[model samples]
Target: MSESKSYTGGCACGAVTYRIDGDPMAVRQCWCRHCQKLSTGGPTHNAFFMADAIAVDGTLASNAHAADSGNELSWYFCASCGTQLFGASSARPQMRAVRLGSLDQAHELQPTAAIWVQEAPGWVRIDPAMEQHPAQPPAPPPQNQS
Candidate 1:
């Protein structure tokens, strides 16, 4: 069998670092207002992976709030530099969304879908090739058990 891919990244101030031992289940660009605010007016790119596949090596600060979809969302960041690292939704507790920008520059992941597009700003231009969802989509399929 082929070896699973590994990815490593850290917060801007180097106060937080993480490693993932498997491939992402999905990568998406989220245009939800909450995500926009976190991204400073742009969409947040994230790669979703099984929570069990990730290992974090630093203390992280986090905030939790109810999202428009009514899911309890929690975001983790670096306390020193405030760089967003990961986001988790109560709806999918077994998964974690890792901010694409927080990953090492060499990582090749890309958003294949754009979600919550109805809330995107008028001036924003989403790639036409990506799958679009006007609001929250169904959860990604569960990881294989093998």
Candidate 2:
């Protein structure tokens, strides 16, 4: 087990901000087409954490879409910078996905898995050491306070 200190972050324009505590349950590099659309044709490096562990501030613009799993997913972004910051999904109400790029400490968080490998473009190279999955990886354990 490992422990990470609380961290604060925001969008590039500082219009939307967040303070999150506790280590993330998982960090992933997702190559789904939707992810590629979000990241300009690259994987989106994201971290999943319990919703209770985070506090967000400032106004945001949001959009809803269906994920590859056919679940409703809503993303919140900074209206000023058009930077996507966080995501909430109907399939995983207890968890929220934070875009790693928005985190001030993103450099320290590494993707432990690469998902949607089958959808990745041939030119993209994923780390050989990372766990790869054709689709979504197995669900992570629920957050535990004790």
Q: Mind giving the per-residue lDDT tens digits that candidate 2 earns over 1-146?
A: 67767878899988789999888888998898888998999998888988899998988899999876888988889988889898888988889889998997645788989999999999988999999999877777887757
Instruction: Choose the strongest candidate by lDDT.
Output: 1
Model 1, span 35-132: residue lDDT tens: 99999999999999999999999899999999767889999999888999999999999999999999976978999999999999999999999999
* TM-score, per-candidate, Cα-based: 0.95, 0.91
lDDT of each: 0.93, 0.87
TM for candidate 2 is 0.91
What pairs collide in candidate 1?
A: none
